[model samples]
Target: MEVEITTEEKILIAARKVFIEKGWDGARMQEIADNAGINKALLHYYFRNKEQLFKRVFAGIVGKLIPNLNTIIQSEQPIFEKIQAFIDAYLDFLLANQELPLFVANELSRNANLIVGAFEENGLKPMVGQMVMEIFQAIENKQIRPINPAHLLMNIVSMCVFPFMGRSIFQKVLMQVPEEMYQELLKQRKKEIYEMVYHSIVL
Candidate 1:
Protein backbone atom coordinates (compact mmCIF):
# COMPACT_ATOMS: atom_id res chain seq x y z
CA MET A 1 0.00 0.00 0.00
CA GLU A 2 1.16 3.48 -0.84
CA VAL A 3 1.22 6.11 1.84
CA GLU A 4 0.25 9.54 0.63
CA ILE A 5 2.56 12.44 1.38
CA THR A 6 0.90 15.59 2.65
CA THR A 7 1.62 19.05 1.30
CA GLU A 8 3.73 19.86 4.35
CA GLU A 9 5.75 16.68 3.91
CA LYS A 10 6.32 17.50 0.26
CA ILE A 11 7.50 20.96 1.26
CA LEU A 12 9.80 19.58 3.88
CA ILE A 13 11.24 17.01 1.48
CA ALA A 14 11.95 19.67 -1.09
CA ALA A 15 13.31 22.03 1.56
CA ARG A 16 15.74 19.42 2.88
CA LYS A 17 17.21 18.84 -0.55
CA VAL A 18 17.63 22.55 -1.20
CA PHE A 19 19.03 23.22 2.28
CA ILE A 20 21.53 20.40 2.03
CA GLU A 21 22.72 21.46 -1.37
CA LYS A 22 22.87 25.18 -0.70
CA GLY A 23 23.15 25.63 3.07
CA TRP A 24 20.89 28.01 4.97
CA ASP A 25 22.62 31.12 3.70
CA GLY A 26 22.49 29.93 0.11
CA ALA A 27 19.01 28.44 -0.02
CA ARG A 28 16.23 30.54 -1.52
CA MET A 29 12.49 30.37 -0.88
CA GLN A 30 11.52 30.45 -4.57
CA GLU A 31 13.89 27.60 -5.34
CA ILE A 32 12.42 25.55 -2.55
CA ALA A 33 8.91 26.30 -3.71
CA ASP A 34 9.83 25.30 -7.24
CA ASN A 35 11.39 22.06 -6.06
CA ALA A 36 8.26 21.36 -4.02
CA GLY A 37 6.08 21.91 -7.09
CA ILE A 38 4.26 24.72 -5.34
CA ASN A 39 4.06 28.39 -6.09
CA LYS A 40 5.96 30.89 -3.94
CA ALA A 41 2.76 32.31 -2.46
CA LEU A 42 1.55 28.85 -1.51
CA LEU A 43 4.88 28.04 0.06
CA HIS A 44 4.64 31.25 2.03
CA TYR A 45 1.20 30.22 3.15
CA TYR A 46 2.70 27.09 4.66
CA PHE A 47 5.95 28.67 5.85
CA ARG A 48 6.10 32.37 6.50
CA ASN A 49 9.73 32.73 5.52
CA LYS A 50 12.89 30.88 4.63
CA GLU A 51 14.11 30.99 8.24
CA GLN A 52 10.94 29.35 9.52
CA LEU A 53 11.17 26.63 6.89
CA PHE A 54 14.84 26.11 7.63
CA LYS A 55 14.12 25.74 11.34
CA ARG A 56 11.50 23.11 10.63
CA VAL A 57 13.95 21.20 8.42
CA PHE A 58 16.69 21.38 11.03
CA ALA A 59 14.31 20.30 13.79
CA GLY A 60 13.10 17.41 11.68
CA ILE A 61 16.65 16.16 11.15
CA VAL A 62 17.31 16.41 14.89
CA GLY A 63 14.07 14.54 15.55
CA LYS A 64 15.18 11.69 13.30
CA LEU A 65 18.66 11.44 14.78
CA ILE A 66 17.73 11.71 18.47
CA PRO A 67 15.17 8.90 18.74
CA ASN A 68 17.84 6.46 17.65
CA LEU A 69 20.10 7.65 20.47
CA ASN A 70 17.24 7.43 22.94
CA THR A 71 16.68 3.82 21.90
CA ILE A 72 20.36 2.88 22.09
CA ILE A 73 20.87 4.54 25.44
CA GLN A 74 17.83 2.84 26.97
CA SER A 75 18.86 -0.62 25.72
CA GLU A 76 20.48 -3.33 27.85
CA GLN A 77 23.61 -3.49 25.70
CA PRO A 78 26.98 -3.43 27.44
CA ILE A 79 29.02 -0.21 27.34
CA PHE A 80 31.32 -1.32 24.54
CA GLU A 81 28.41 -2.70 22.58
CA LYS A 82 26.50 0.53 23.12
CA ILE A 83 29.47 2.51 21.83
CA GLN A 84 29.77 0.30 18.77
CA ALA A 85 26.05 0.48 18.14
CA PHE A 86 26.06 4.26 18.35
CA ILE A 87 28.97 4.55 15.96
CA ASP A 88 27.32 2.17 13.52
CA ALA A 89 23.97 3.93 13.67
CA TYR A 90 25.47 7.42 13.51
CA LEU A 91 27.78 6.59 10.63
CA ASP A 92 24.95 4.93 8.75
CA PHE A 93 22.92 8.09 9.11
CA LEU A 94 25.84 10.22 7.89
CA LEU A 95 26.31 7.91 4.94
CA ALA A 96 22.70 8.31 3.91
CA ASN A 97 22.82 12.08 4.46
CA GLN A 98 26.31 12.77 3.19
CA GLU A 99 25.72 16.49 2.79
CA LEU A 100 24.15 16.99 6.18
CA PRO A 101 27.30 17.58 8.22
CA LEU A 102 28.50 20.35 5.99
CA PHE A 103 25.06 21.87 5.88
CA VAL A 104 24.74 21.80 9.65
CA ALA A 105 28.23 23.18 10.24
CA ASN A 106 27.59 26.04 7.86
CA GLU A 107 24.33 26.99 9.50
CA LEU A 108 25.77 26.62 12.98
CA SER A 109 28.50 29.11 12.14
CA ARG A 110 25.90 31.60 10.97
CA ASN A 111 23.54 31.29 13.93
CA ALA A 112 24.67 28.89 16.63
CA ASN A 113 21.82 29.83 18.94
CA LEU A 114 19.25 28.61 16.44
CA ILE A 115 20.93 25.22 16.01
CA VAL A 116 21.52 24.85 19.73
CA GLY A 117 17.93 25.70 20.48
CA ALA A 118 16.68 23.15 18.00
CA PHE A 119 18.80 20.43 19.58
CA GLU A 120 17.74 21.36 23.12
CA GLU A 121 14.10 21.34 22.12
CA ASN A 122 14.56 17.86 20.65
CA GLY A 123 15.77 16.38 23.99
CA LEU A 124 19.51 16.30 23.27
CA LYS A 125 20.38 17.59 26.74
CA PRO A 126 18.63 14.78 28.60
CA MET A 127 20.01 12.21 26.18
CA VAL A 128 23.54 13.47 26.77
CA GLY A 129 22.99 13.41 30.52
CA GLN A 130 21.78 9.82 30.31
CA MET A 131 24.77 8.86 28.20
CA VAL A 132 27.06 10.52 30.71
CA MET A 133 25.51 8.56 33.52
CA GLU A 134 25.99 5.36 31.57
CA ILE A 135 29.66 6.17 31.15
CA PHE A 136 30.05 6.82 34.87
CA GLN A 137 28.31 3.53 35.64
CA ALA A 138 30.71 1.72 33.34
CA ILE A 139 33.66 3.34 35.07
CA GLU A 140 32.36 2.42 38.53
CA ASN A 141 31.83 -1.16 37.39
CA LYS A 142 35.43 -1.25 36.10
CA GLN A 143 34.14 -1.99 32.63
CA ILE A 144 36.33 0.75 31.18
CA ARG A 145 39.18 2.94 32.36
CA PRO A 146 38.24 5.89 34.50
CA ILE A 147 37.89 9.03 32.44
CA ASN A 148 35.75 12.14 32.33
CA PRO A 149 32.52 11.02 30.73
CA ALA A 150 32.11 14.36 28.98
CA HIS A 151 35.50 14.09 27.30
CA LEU A 152 34.80 10.54 26.20
CA LEU A 153 31.48 11.57 24.76
CA MET A 154 33.08 14.49 22.94
CA ASN A 155 35.83 12.29 21.56
CA ILE A 156 33.36 9.73 20.28
CA VAL A 157 31.19 12.35 18.59
CA SER A 158 34.17 14.20 17.08
CA MET A 159 35.66 11.05 15.59
CA CYS A 160 32.38 10.05 14.00
CA VAL A 161 31.28 13.48 12.78
CA PHE A 162 34.56 15.11 11.69
CA PRO A 163 35.09 13.01 8.58
CA PHE A 164 31.74 13.95 7.15
CA MET A 165 31.94 17.56 8.31
CA GLY A 166 35.33 17.87 6.65
CA ARG A 167 34.42 15.74 3.68
CA SER A 168 35.71 18.08 0.98
CA ILE A 169 39.18 18.29 2.45
CA PHE A 170 39.28 14.69 3.63
CA GLN A 171 37.98 13.34 0.34
CA LYS A 172 39.81 15.61 -2.09
CA VAL A 173 43.03 16.83 -0.48
CA LEU A 174 43.88 14.53 2.41
CA MET A 175 42.94 11.24 0.80
CA GLN A 176 42.44 12.40 -2.78
CA VAL A 177 40.10 9.48 -3.26
CA PRO A 178 37.28 9.30 -5.76
CA GLU A 179 33.71 9.56 -4.49
CA GLU A 180 33.21 5.79 -4.65
CA MET A 181 36.38 5.13 -2.69
CA TYR A 182 35.57 7.83 -0.12
CA GLN A 183 32.15 6.29 0.44
CA GLU A 184 33.78 2.89 0.92
CA LEU A 185 36.14 4.44 3.43
CA LEU A 186 33.22 5.93 5.35
CA LYS A 187 31.64 2.46 5.59
CA GLN A 188 34.92 1.13 6.93
CA ARG A 189 35.07 4.05 9.35
CA LYS A 190 32.29 2.65 11.54
CA LYS A 191 34.51 -0.20 12.63
CA GLU A 192 37.63 1.93 12.86
CA ILE A 193 35.88 4.45 15.12
CA TYR A 194 34.54 1.72 17.40
CA GLU A 195 38.01 0.17 17.74
CA MET A 196 39.77 3.47 18.41
CA VAL A 197 37.18 4.46 20.99
CA TYR A 198 37.14 1.01 22.54
CA HIS A 199 40.92 0.81 22.89
CA SER A 200 41.09 4.33 24.27
CA ILE A 201 38.86 3.65 27.27
CA VAL A 202 38.89 -0.13 27.63
CA LEU A 203 40.82 -1.65 30.53
Candidate 2:
Protein backbone atom coordinates (compact mmCIF):
# COMPACT_ATOMS: atom_id res chain seq x y z
CA MET A 1 0.00 0.00 0.00
CA GLU A 2 1.20 3.55 -0.73
CA VAL A 3 1.84 5.63 2.36
CA GLU A 4 -0.35 8.66 2.68
CA ILE A 5 1.31 12.06 2.86
CA THR A 6 -0.43 14.51 5.16
CA THR A 7 -2.02 17.62 3.71
CA GLU A 8 0.45 19.92 5.44
CA GLU A 9 3.51 17.98 4.29
CA LYS A 10 2.23 17.85 0.75
CA ILE A 11 1.61 21.59 0.73
CA LEU A 12 4.99 22.39 2.25
CA ILE A 13 6.79 20.04 -0.17
CA ALA A 14 5.08 21.60 -3.15
CA ALA A 15 5.59 25.12 -1.79
CA ARG A 16 9.30 24.48 -1.29
CA LYS A 17 9.75 23.54 -4.94
CA VAL A 18 7.71 26.50 -6.19
CA PHE A 19 9.46 28.96 -3.92
CA ILE A 20 12.86 27.61 -4.89
CA GLU A 21 12.05 27.83 -8.56
CA LYS A 22 10.20 31.15 -8.76
CA GLY A 23 10.87 32.79 -5.39
CA TRP A 24 8.20 34.30 -3.14
CA ASP A 25 7.17 37.07 -5.51
CA GLY A 26 6.61 34.78 -8.46
CA ALA A 27 5.08 31.79 -6.67
CA ARG A 28 1.31 31.65 -6.51
CA MET A 29 -0.90 29.67 -4.17
CA GLN A 30 -2.74 28.09 -7.08
CA GLU A 31 0.49 26.85 -8.57
CA ILE A 32 1.47 25.39 -5.22
CA ALA A 33 -1.93 23.66 -4.94
CA ASP A 34 -1.70 22.24 -8.45
CA ASN A 35 1.78 20.94 -7.81
CA ALA A 36 0.67 19.50 -4.49
CA GLY A 37 -2.23 17.71 -6.21
CA ILE A 38 -4.64 19.58 -4.01
CA ASN A 39 -7.07 22.41 -4.59
CA LYS A 40 -6.35 26.06 -3.83
CA ALA A 41 -8.83 26.26 -0.94
CA LEU A 42 -7.06 23.47 0.90
CA LEU A 43 -3.69 25.13 0.35
CA HIS A 44 -5.06 28.37 1.74
CA TYR A 45 -6.67 26.49 4.62
CA TYR A 46 -3.24 25.26 5.66
CA PHE A 47 -1.09 28.29 4.78
CA ARG A 48 -3.50 31.24 4.78
CA ASN A 49 -1.61 32.97 1.94
CA LYS A 50 1.64 33.19 0.04
CA GLU A 51 3.46 35.38 2.56
CA GLN A 52 2.68 32.96 5.35
CA LEU A 53 3.56 29.96 3.23
CA PHE A 54 6.81 31.56 2.06
CA LYS A 55 7.84 32.32 5.63
CA ARG A 56 7.36 28.69 6.59
CA VAL A 57 9.32 27.59 3.53
CA PHE A 58 12.06 30.14 4.20
CA ALA A 59 12.31 29.05 7.81
CA GLY A 60 12.83 25.45 6.73
CA ILE A 61 15.66 26.50 4.40
CA VAL A 62 17.31 28.70 7.00
CA GLY A 63 16.92 25.98 9.60
CA LYS A 64 19.14 23.67 7.55
CA LEU A 65 22.09 26.08 7.70
CA ILE A 66 22.05 28.35 10.78
CA PRO A 67 22.49 25.82 13.57
CA ASN A 68 25.71 24.50 12.06
CA LEU A 69 27.28 27.89 12.61
CA ASN A 70 26.12 27.75 16.21
CA THR A 71 27.83 24.40 16.62
CA ILE A 72 31.14 25.69 15.28
CA ILE A 73 30.94 28.69 17.58
CA GLN A 74 30.17 26.69 20.69
CA SER A 75 32.82 24.05 20.10
CA GLU A 76 36.02 23.83 22.17
CA GLN A 77 38.21 23.72 19.06
CA PRO A 78 40.94 26.28 18.45
CA ILE A 79 40.05 29.32 16.38
CA PHE A 80 41.94 28.15 13.30
CA GLU A 81 40.30 24.75 13.51
CA LYS A 82 36.93 26.39 13.88
CA ILE A 83 37.60 28.47 10.81
CA GLN A 84 38.59 25.44 8.78
CA ALA A 85 35.58 23.42 9.91
CA PHE A 86 33.20 26.29 9.32
CA ILE A 87 34.49 26.88 5.80
CA ASP A 88 34.25 23.21 5.02
CA ALA A 89 30.69 22.85 6.29
CA TYR A 90 29.40 26.20 5.06
CA LEU A 91 30.73 25.85 1.53
CA ASP A 92 29.59 22.27 1.24
CA PHE A 93 26.08 23.23 2.31
CA LEU A 94 25.94 26.15 -0.12
CA LEU A 95 27.23 24.09 -3.01
CA ALA A 96 24.58 21.49 -2.42
CA ASN A 97 21.87 24.17 -2.22
CA GLN A 98 22.93 26.43 -5.04
CA GLU A 99 19.57 28.14 -5.38
CA LEU A 100 19.33 29.04 -1.69
CA PRO A 101 21.43 32.19 -1.49
CA LEU A 102 19.55 33.94 -4.27
CA PHE A 103 16.23 32.99 -2.74
CA VAL A 104 17.32 34.26 0.65
CA ALA A 105 18.80 37.46 -0.76
CA ASN A 106 15.67 38.25 -2.73
CA GLU A 107 13.34 37.59 0.20
CA LEU A 108 15.54 39.56 2.59
CA SER A 109 15.45 42.63 0.38
CA ARG A 110 11.69 42.94 0.70
CA ASN A 111 11.13 41.26 4.04
CA ALA A 112 14.09 42.03 6.23
CA ASN A 113 12.00 42.18 9.36
CA LEU A 114 10.41 38.83 8.63
CA ILE A 115 13.82 37.23 8.15
CA VAL A 116 15.03 38.79 11.38
CA GLY A 117 12.01 37.38 13.12
CA ALA A 118 12.85 33.93 11.87
CA PHE A 119 16.36 34.12 13.32
CA GLU A 120 15.11 35.49 16.59
CA GLU A 121 12.49 32.78 16.84
CA ASN A 122 15.23 30.20 16.32
CA GLY A 123 17.30 31.57 19.29
CA LEU A 124 20.06 33.37 17.42
CA LYS A 125 21.16 35.57 20.31
CA PRO A 126 22.81 32.90 22.45
CA MET A 127 24.66 31.50 19.45
CA VAL A 128 25.89 34.97 18.61
CA GLY A 129 27.02 35.51 22.17
CA GLN A 130 28.91 32.23 22.18
CA MET A 131 30.70 33.21 19.01
CA VAL A 132 31.55 36.60 20.44
CA MET A 133 33.01 34.98 23.53
CA GLU A 134 35.08 32.66 21.37
CA ILE A 135 36.44 35.59 19.40
CA PHE A 136 37.37 37.40 22.59
CA GLN A 137 39.10 34.36 23.96
CA ALA A 138 41.15 33.96 20.80
CA ILE A 139 42.19 37.60 20.82
CA GLU A 140 43.06 37.55 24.52
CA ASN A 141 45.26 34.51 24.01
CA LYS A 142 46.99 36.29 21.12
CA GLN A 143 46.24 33.29 18.92
CA ILE A 144 44.66 35.67 16.46
CA ARG A 145 45.04 39.35 15.65
CA PRO A 146 42.73 41.87 17.23
CA ILE A 147 39.62 42.52 15.13
CA ASN A 148 35.94 43.20 15.62
CA PRO A 149 34.46 39.73 15.70
CA ALA A 150 31.22 40.81 14.08
CA HIS A 151 33.07 42.40 11.20
CA LEU A 152 35.30 39.36 10.92
CA LEU A 153 32.27 37.10 10.86
CA MET A 154 30.69 39.18 8.12
CA ASN A 155 33.88 39.04 6.08
CA ILE A 156 34.04 35.29 6.43
CA VAL A 157 30.37 34.90 5.54
CA SER A 158 30.71 37.19 2.52
CA MET A 159 33.74 35.31 1.23
CA CYS A 160 31.96 32.00 1.68
CA VAL A 161 28.66 33.14 0.20
CA PHE A 162 29.78 35.32 -2.74
CA PRO A 163 30.60 32.42 -5.03
CA PHE A 164 27.08 31.07 -4.64
CA MET A 165 25.63 34.52 -5.21
CA GLY A 166 27.59 34.76 -8.43
CA ARG A 167 27.12 31.13 -9.46
CA SER A 168 25.48 31.77 -12.82
CA ILE A 169 27.87 34.52 -13.78
CA PHE A 170 30.91 32.63 -12.54
CA GLN A 171 29.95 29.36 -14.20
CA LYS A 172 28.47 30.73 -17.42
CA VAL A 173 30.33 33.98 -18.09
CA LEU A 174 33.61 34.68 -16.36
CA MET A 175 35.58 31.50 -15.71
CA GLN A 176 33.42 29.30 -17.94
CA VAL A 177 34.78 26.14 -16.35
CA PRO A 178 33.18 22.80 -17.21
CA GLU A 179 30.65 21.41 -14.71
CA GLU A 180 32.98 18.78 -13.28
CA MET A 181 35.92 21.19 -13.18
CA TYR A 182 33.78 23.89 -11.62
CA GLN A 183 32.73 21.54 -8.85
CA GLU A 184 36.36 20.56 -8.25
CA LEU A 185 37.22 24.26 -8.08
CA LEU A 186 34.53 24.72 -5.43
CA LYS A 187 36.13 21.93 -3.41
CA GLN A 188 39.46 23.72 -3.70
CA ARG A 189 37.82 26.93 -2.55
CA LYS A 190 37.02 25.43 0.86
CA LYS A 191 40.73 25.14 1.51
CA GLU A 192 41.53 28.49 -0.08
CA ILE A 193 38.98 30.32 2.04
CA TYR A 194 40.10 28.51 5.19
CA GLU A 195 43.73 29.41 4.55
CA MET A 196 42.94 33.02 3.75
CA VAL A 197 40.79 33.42 6.85
CA TYR A 198 43.30 31.68 9.08
CA HIS A 199 46.36 33.58 7.84
CA SER A 200 44.57 36.89 8.05
CA ILE A 201 43.93 36.51 11.76
CA VAL A 202 46.59 34.08 13.00
CA LEU A 203 49.54 35.51 14.89
Q: Estimate each model's TM-score.
A: 0.91, 0.90
Residue 4 lDDT, candidate 1, scale 0-100: 93
Worst 10 residues of 1 by lDDT: 118-127
Q: Go through the candidates in order and give each one's C-alpha lDDT.
A: 0.86, 0.82
In candidate 2, list every pair of residues with a backbone clash: none
lDDT of 1 by residue, 1-203 (tens): 99999989999999999988888778899999999999999999999988778778888877777789779988999989998988888888888777788777888899898788767665554377788998999999999999999898888889988988998899899889999998888899988988999899999
**Candidate 2 residues 83-140, lDDT tens each?**
7887788888888887888878887897788777766775544376677788898899
What clash count does candidate 2 reach? 0
Best by lDDT: 1
Model 2 / residue 172 / CA error / Å:
2.1
Candidate 1 achieves a global lDDT of 0.86
Among residues 3 or more apart in sequence or in different chains, the pairs in candidate 1 whose N, CA or C atoms overlap within 3 Å are none
